[model samples]
Target: MEALTTMKKKKTRLVVRKGNENIALKVEDIAFIYRDNTIIVAVDKEEKKYLCDRNLSALEEELDESMFFRANRKYLVNIQYIRGFKSFEKVKLEVSLLIPTCNHSIIISQETAPLFKKWINEE
Candidate 1:
């Protein structure tokens, strides 16, 4: 007899709420996920917002690591949506995205700046 091993499949879609309806949104279509006050919101490439039932930490673990980067405590950004990044206030980095976010800016801390650069350059 041979032993078998199994690997968890990464999530391709997320169930989100818009008004009273639950929508099945493709992970590829999501530009970013952010904490807006007490709610967890997922924004698509087109800038539409949906409510997520799970927290950011849970979503980070479930989503593909290569595709999503935990930009900060409040943001989980998609690599496909990153337009560019530049040095900000010396040590920090300001990331620009294809779709605008509610905060208007995504700032990566000095501690995470190097990691962000490496991840962006890898792709």
Candidate 2:
């Protein structure tokens, strides 16, 4: 009998929509993912926003844990795009990103702050 081991497949890019056009963006180039109404949006380092077909939860599963962190219910932030973070009210955290999103607020819960701290420090 042969045993099957799952391989860690890293996703390099994703195909997203900009109007009627489908564009492939490198995962490393993405700044963050956010929810806007019923749509999921992917923002790049250049601050360009693209419409993603996958929901936030679905995208969360696909993204690398080392590279991305779910800041809240509405945001999945890339480590490469993190500018800084601060302590927020009520034991929460406020994160500032290099690429800004007009519609979403970037904040992390108290429980996730310690984990986020460790992730950012890893080489």
Candidate 3:
């Protein structure tokens, strides 16, 4: 029970950079996090983007897994922003978000499709 509670207790605020300014954004407002070349970016529900100092893997560990999913190597998606998913090229699953991503589609490989399905369906 203690371990579960600790895991569920995620960081409420994330410190992100916007040019020279460092802003503390509420985690709930974040729609997704993605790797853009060498930089990690966080997108909010309003479609605003901010730069994260941490890498995708590090952010993934800090976030509550129940609210976020590793959609692909590039994206850490918030479940609240996911609209739906569909078959992609017959072998993969393509995820659609409520807010559009950075002109790229979120794809789940065939091997990870089952895990993604279970995560999405869980209470």
lDDT of each prediction vs. the true structure? 0.91, 0.86, 0.91
lDDT of 1 at 91: 98
* Order by lDDT, highest first: 1, 3, 2
- Residue-level lDDT of model 2, residues 21-103, one tens digit each, is 99999999999999988989998988899999999888888888889998888899999888888899968889988765544
Candidate 2 regions off by >4 Å?
A: 1-7, 100-104
RMSD of each: 2.5, 2.5, 2.2
Enumerate residue pairs that collide in model 1. none
> What residue pairs clash in candidate 3, if any at all?
none
lDDT of 3 at 40: 95
Going through the candidates in order, what is the number of backbone clashes in each? Answer: 0, 0, 0
The ten-residue window of minimal lDDT in model 1 covers 1-10
Looking at model 3, report the run of 10 residues with the lowest lDDT sum: 96-105
Q: How far off is model 2, as Cα RMSD?
A: 2.5
Let me know the TM-score candidate 1 reaches against the reference structure: 0.90
Model 3 Cα lDDT, one tens digit per residue, 4-83: 98876778889999999999999889999999899899999999999999999989988889989998889999999889
Q: Among all windows of ten consecutive residues in candidate 2, which has the lowest summed lDDT?
A: 1-10
Q: How close is candidate 2 to the true structure, as a TM-score?
A: 0.88
